[model samples]
Target chain A: MILVNENTRVVVQGITGREGGFHAERCMAYGTQIVAGVTPGRGGTLWQDKVPVFDTMEQAVRETGANCSLIFVPAPFATDAILEAVDAGIGVIACITEGIPVQESVKVYSYLKDKRVHLIGPNCPGLISPGARCKVGIMPGDIHRPGTIGVVSRSGTLTYEAVAQLTEAGLGQSTCVGIGGDPVTGTDFVDILKLFNKDPDTEGVVLIGEIGGAKEQEAARYIKRSFKKPVVALVVGATAPPGKRMGHAGAIITGVSGRAEEKIRALREAGATIVPSPGEIGVTMKRALRR
Target chain B: MKIHEHQAKAIFARYGIPVPEGGVASTPQEAREIAQRLGGRVVVKAQVHAGGRGRAGGIKVVDSPEAAQQAAVALLGKHLVTHQTGPEGVPVSKVLVEQVVPVERELYLAIVVDGSGKAPVIIGSEAGGMDIEEVAAIHPEKILQVRVDPIIGFQPYMGRDLAYAMHLPSAVVRNAATIIGNLHRVFIDEDATLAEINPLVLTPDGKLLALDGKLNLDDDAFFRHPTHQQLQDPEQEDPLEVEAGKYDISYVKLDGDVGCMVNGAGLAMATLDVINAAHAQPANFLDIGGGGDEAKVAQAFRLVVADPKVKRVFINVFGGILRCDVAARGIVQAYGELKTPMPIVVRMRGTNAEEGRQILNDSGIPVRLVADLKEAIAQLQQVGRR
Candidate 1:
């Protein structure tokens, strides 16, 4: 399991809110170890009549021995929630909350540099390990099946599209991670690719990227150097105009490096089979693995 | 969330950064009054969000107040087309009139978020007063960058290093460093993604003045800076896009015939790409977000069909937090409300997808449901052919 497994004790931040409660129930139904819930001033309460609720992360950690944090806090307080989780010694954090300011995200990124923690996203769908039955995000659990293909993407529904296609192609995913669509995210493609490369269960990897930033190029370089697995890549936003942010904050073509063609060329040169469109993600990955 | 040049200059001046004396004018009379007060050679610049105003005849320099009025009259309420703005261009409602400083040299300075680094980087160059992208492409080595750690923040020594790297004169190195520090402070304090001073000029008196200023605030950080949010001009944006924002939907208008409404940003862009691949242009990019209820989805649908160029609508939703049933109901409701004969195609999956498809199938609406992306593209192509 790259980020989560059956033994991972999860704490639900902002569990009392509507979105948090709803997703927590879904994750629990998927057989995840949702050990505790945290909402300020909601201590000693029972969430869904089973999970324990605490006012702070520290108390939740002390009582439940939670190792992972799934945050659904609002944008304004989401940064503080991540820091709280970090301080409480949570090993892994997946923030589902979107629209966190870049300044706050950068500060969190700086603070987490020395800490022994894995932060997934401030604006992402989160990650899931189908084989381990460990779902840690807002992704629909039923669509994922247990297998060896590892998928990492900078999108939410687009990751779902790829995962569903993979499952349909008889290539069940070991884990699917959405690093997020924000300009500054906690974890990136390279970090997740490294985990996927080392995991024994993950046979191959599929990287989904969009416009904006040189992150795909960085991942392409890493794949060429050390990754010893079949890789298939798909970069969207080929038709997107420059400078106009297409829904995602990070999906804008600012300069020459942020264009989709540049990223596609870099990935193609690095020996990864490039899928021409979103429709081809599954068959392309299967083909790359066979070769 | 880009602020006008005058607004950026105001913010810069508040931080004790030196900028040429300027005033914003919306009318020719106001321009004349401001120019008379400056009492010297002044430049009238269109206060649009785009760059390249100087090359597009949006900027005019005059020695007299009458000439300033004439320049304002020529620019005000007229569309100023530049390379940044498309053929239609943006209307110049206001102009900034400033006293022109005698320049000894021009330098570039800006603080922007380095996306990959996840930190703010201070970019400086000796070559300025032109497009920075051009300079970066032609002379890549001329661009100097210093990444500022958000934890320790921008240090004075880093500013000193940047000043020395720019090869500034000894007399103004300390002053340049101070301005850089102040600019960094402004970037952090204002929650700005970009705080730039292109053409930081050196006057004959050895004083550094920000000749042109541009500041882009982080839209996500607007909750903290409510005052900054008030600076947004709705007139400058597409009316439909502004309407979509009111319903918490992200919408960008495009010159395409097929309208796309998807749940996520990446999926929406991919939808556009696929539509284009099918030889059908997407009229707009619209995302109703993760948890779109019936009402929000209806609003999003209305926003998409509101575009006259949109002949058909395509809804591709891989529902997670947003249930397929809810989206289907919303689309059906919107179709009924609009009472238009526009064709609609949907590819719904994930949570409650079967129920959602059933709802759409029985809605008495003539909607085509496709099983996969390829099928959906084929349907879109057929619709375009009609």
Candidate 2:
């Protein structure tokens, strides 16, 4: 059911900008069928890799027939790029920009739900379906191999750390999605978990979560009811006592249900393997897979 | 970051907060000249960025200008240890020779961004010149907090209410109002993380003054106020951590085994906890935040590998915005350059991870990637474990 194929044409917003150009070049290097770039007032300009450029996403989609969009726009312009990509009917959009204000992320989140679109990270590293030969966002591509475990995280580096652990144990991944650290993300942990559960390539999954958000608990509940595949969960911010400790945007600790202990309890009750340390994530995933 | 006492007092003066008249001096001669001009018994205080200096011999009451000069000669360029600044002594860069005021009473007042409810709170107390933690533990009721409306900030009347609760006299209460107003102004204008006036003294003349001060500015907002940044004393900060910040990586030095490199602040903190639970202390918290370029990762790797305490390097990256392979290449490149014998425990997830692993494997580096969080942590716990 992974409908997107390797040849899915892609366009990058803010493509001439530093992050855009960097990732655009990386994606191009990985042979991700990149088609066009959209940067206002810089239309018809071309980056060195020679992807056709446009002033607007609509034009980029119209001219280049790009179905998927990689957005490397700055935080101040993230909402606009996401909205524009959605409006342009670019079926898939990945916003890799960090520090997008929470309010902007909320607005963009609301905008994405009404449309038939799959949006990844306003503060994420983007998504990669391995062995399919596609790269989007800032994630380093070379470490990945096609295998059973699929990763979905609210954190970029934590996800990378988790995936790296998996790969070290000779456990390859089917897909890994950093859902972004913002409170309001395009895809939630449960949503990505659902995707991984259905994907045949992903036999097991790892979810690296932080404090502050209730997404981890929600994901645990969803796994209890829906997921047939084994899941390994590691919740960060454990020793951080409640005096002034708060976690990520979606990290839901403090108001009773959001505590690390509570989340770990829920995950334990939900039949998912829980790893206390970040380093144990890989072994935990392999053990979960064996079970 | 924290600002020195003299700098804090200067900022207080700008906002109309009453601080003891003082001049900063880099040398004993300058201290003597300033004390002579003040023409009275003065307090020679080491201008380090720590509290509890009085207990650490960093503060001296000099009866004459000659005494002030002698005190400055002993303190300047020397390290002063305080209970608050940890065991490492704070380097005294400047001496603050201020006109001494007879204190009838001492009170505490501070405005800090309360991480709870995402609101700012004013913490004030009748008893001052003591650790706020000790105050909270013992006479918690004497403390007053008035949460401000984020839109309007602290109103003047609320400041008066807090002062009243602290049981100030009529004359001191009015001074408290102006001080609170000044504090609010400083908080809003400078985007301060914490601003405190400990021992806001009531003089023999029944006048109120901010006797001692501390201000912590938000680093993220530092770009807006370049001038206030001159107040930073790099001597108080860890050199490696400062170096890490240049690369945009958040590296906090801790005593532990594995050198952790993760993106995202929230995740990095959690990574430390896990290493601790595994009975291994994380040597450093290196958030090779977001960009994850070869240069940054290389710098981070060199730093961790250079540390003799770091028996293992646990790299747990979930490639969301960062690619595992790019990180792998960075590791490969950095390892080749550093040529370190330290064992590296590699665990990567999220987008293009295999290519990253391939790069690490191909580099002839014996980096091992783990498939689970607990196992990798366990591996990292035993640096030489196969």
Candidate 3:
């Protein structure tokens, strides 16, 4: 159990908003421990007529002993929300908000360098551990199952696509994490891979990457040097054009480093089995695990 | 969002950076007047977002106002093709007329947010007036960078180190550092992702001036900078893309026939790759986003079919927050409104996928719903061959 498990008590930030309220209920329905809700003005109320709502993170943390934070705040105020959770001494934070400015993300990322806390995303689908029954994101909970393969990606629905295929192939996952598509994120492929490397239950890992930055290359270097498990890699955006942002803010080919071909080459050279297309992620991972 | 050189210079000037005396002119007469005001020795540069303007004959040096008018006439209201722009090129509606400087050396300076480093980095090089990518590839040692800690902010010593590394003259090194500091300030204050001064010229008089400027503002930070959002020039963008933007859709027009509409950015790109792998081309890249409602999906469908080159359509949705039923209903609604009969292939999975499949199957519309992505591609290819 990495990042989140059954014992992890969760706090829903911006719980009064439409996205926050909806996802909070779904996460609860998935059997996640919804400890408390935080909405500044809407304190002293009950969310879904069960969980308590607090005006501040400090109050929520003290009252509910919530160890993890799931943020669905809008982009403009999301930075402050993440900082609030950080200040409240939350052990784990997952921000599902999208479109946060890079400046704000960089600042938060810099601040978290020395902290022991783990921040998941500002523009991500979050993570889920089916075995632990701990869902802390907006991902569809049914597609995931408890198994040996650990999955991490830089996308949302794409992760779901890979997970659905894995489940159909009877390859369940230990944990599925989306580090986000933003240029700056709290956790990355290397961070999640480190956790998977140490977990005894995680037999193999599936790393999904795209056309942004050199994080994928860095991950490849890590896998080549230290990772103990067989790795399966998929780098998308082979047909994307240069200088054009492909949907994700970070999914643009700025220079030679951000090209998909370069990332795929690095991963392949690192001795990881590369999935040729998105549809092949499942069978590729299963084949790598069998070896 | 990329702003023209003139707009970038204006923004840089506000931050106390020294830019050459220049004015943007939309007409030949206006260019003549601006050139005359600048002592009649000016450089008429086409104001387009694409680069390689000098090699593309988009830039010309003229010594007289009459010649400046002629240069503007040759550039403005014409498509200036460059290596950055496609072969068709972009329309140049304006020209920047600036006083020509006597340059002794050209340097490059820029502040870009390093995605891997997770901070802003100051990049400086002695090699300038050419593509930085080429310089980076050929002489990687020439590119010197200093990472600025976002928590500590941009420090003077960081800029000083970059300027010193560029090996500037002692007389102008401090001034160059100051300009770098100012550029960093502009980058932070304007929410700009990229702020660059290519060919930061050093004149015989020991003065440093920004000969060219380029700034790319962060579209995600538009809520904070409403004025910067107004700087968007729709004429420089594809009309279909501009239309997609109004409905909060992410779209980019490409040269292909299979129109692709997907729910996520990563999935959308993979769809394009899948189409190409099937020996077909993707007309455009469109992402309806994570939380696509019925209306938004309808808008995305309309935009996809709007491209006349679209021979077939591929709708791939792995529904998470956006239920498959919603996407199917939206597609069915769009197909009715569009009333354009074309081969449509949909591959939907995850939440409420069965209901979505039923919605499309009962919509009285002919849609090829494939359970597997590979089968979907094969079916799409079969239709393309027909």
Docking class of 3: high
Q: lDDT tens string, model 3, B1-386?
A: 99999999999899999999989999999999999999999999999999999999999999999999999999999998999887889999999999999999999999999988999999999998878999999989999999998978888888788888888888888899899999999999999899999989999999999999999999999999989888899988889999999998999999999999999998998888888889888999999987789999989999999999998999998888788999999999999976568999999898889999999999988799999779987998889988
Candidate 2 residue-wise lDDT, B332-361, digit = tens: 877887655668888776677778888887
* Superposition error at A102 for model 3 (Å): 0.2
> For residues B156-257, what per-residue lDDT tens digits would candidate 1 score against the true structure?
988899899988988889999999999999999999989999999999999999999999999999999879988898877778988988888999888888
Q: What residue runs in model 1 are displaced by over 4 Å at the alpha carbon? A: none
Q: Which pairs clash inside model 1?
A: none
DockQ, candidate no. 3: 0.84
Q: Residue by residue across A124-243, what tens digits does model 2's lDDT show?
A: 878877768776666677777777788887776667667667778899888788887765577778778877777777788888777665777788899999999888888877654342
lDDT of candidate 3?
0.92
Q: Pick the candidate with the highest DockQ.
A: 1
TM-score of chain A of 3: 0.99
Every model's TM-score = 0.98, 0.70, 0.99
Candidate 1's residue-wise lDDT over A169-264, tens digit each?
999999899999999989989999999889999999999999999999999999999999999999999888888888888888888989999999
**Preferred candidate (TM-score higher): 2 or 3:** 3
- Candidate 1 chain B, poorest ten consecutive residues by summed lDDT: B335-344
lDDT of 2 at A231: 87
